[model samples]
Target: MAEPSNSGGSIVSGVAGRYASALFELAQETGAIDAVAADLSTFEALLAESEDLRRLVGSPVFSAEEQMSAITAILAAAKIGGVAANFIKLVASKRRLFLLPAMIRGYRALVAQAKGIVSARVSVAEAPSEALLAEIRTAIAQAAGAEIDLEVKVDPALIGGLVVRVGSRMIDASLRTKLNSIRLAMKEVR
Candidate 1:
């Protein structure tokens, strides 16, 4: 697997953090981080596509044995072998499948950080065009002075404009927020 860029940092802590850290460390030691990350991305896409699979992982109704068997079969059929395959099986066997999503997120975060890529979330009134997204990426990378991974979410209620958040800093450029500010100013004027 190709290694990501030069993002320097250690993993996080807490339940999800601990699990992510362990998995990341193992993948790193085995030089399989990229492979594991790809597998996890595939798994995440599967979870998003299949409601029954989502329920199976997130709901407490299923027995651990059932989840393990089902997930094992799914992994095998998906041809998702390697550190990722084993790590997921372990999580299911431990009845921690409910935490899988968070673990995946945590893993992605670590991978991003390792790649020296800052993550930015942008919420827009509609799906952005590729040109717009590329523009945003260039702007953010320039501002951050680092490689960036952008996640765009669509919220029609925003009316117009987009909100950009990077780490603890946020730019509330959404029309909804601007309208709210105008309303607040009007109240003050009254």
Candidate 2:
């Protein structure tokens, strides 16, 4: 049998990694990796957009049954089923819902590695237009010598410019950082 794909073994670990790896292998074996990924992306987007959902997942005050009920309704409403839905329900049953985000991230890493894609995160002062996002993705893919899975974040604190992180390398070109550097330089001139 072919070796099961791994999330680099080092990129993700602990409870989240184990769960993610198991799900990834199952999805791969069933030829449903893409479908599972799409479901997970939907779940992740929902989790990001709803404060109540965040609390339900992250808070320990909810009992296992409560979480299971809530998550089941959520999955049904979101039309997320198959292996992804089952895996999430299992997590809820085991009272591990708080680790769902990490598990999704780990799953993403595994998928990216399998597809020869590099995951990159870009933080900017404002949301980039689709054209800008495509340009940035192309540039990063060229620099990394692989297709890029770009995750964009908007942080008004950046003031201007953007910061890109691809693996261990980071390029911080934010106006905030530049001004801080200049301020430190002037302090040294005293």
- For candidate 2, what is the lDDT? 0.93
C-alpha lDDT values of all predictions: 0.89, 0.93
Model 1 RMSD in Å is 3.8
lDDT comparing candidate 1 with the true structure: 0.89
Compared with the true structure, model 2 gives a TM-score of 0.84
Q: After superposition, which runs of candidate 1 have C-alpha atoms over 4 Å from their true positions?
A: 1-11
Error of 1 at 36 (Å): 0.7
lDDT of 1 at 126: 94
Q: Give per-model CA RMSD.
A: 3.8, 2.7
Question: What are the per-residue Cα lDDT tens digits for candidate 1 across 18-68?
Answer: 798788879989999899999999999999999999999999999999999
Q: Number of the top candidate by TM-score?
A: 1
Question: What's the distance in Å from true for residue 105, model 1?
Answer: 1.1
List, residue by residue over 57-133, the lDDT tens digit for candidate 2. 99999999999999999999999999999999999999999999999999998888878988899999999999999
**Looking at model 1, which ten-residue stretch has the lowest summed lDDT?**
1-10
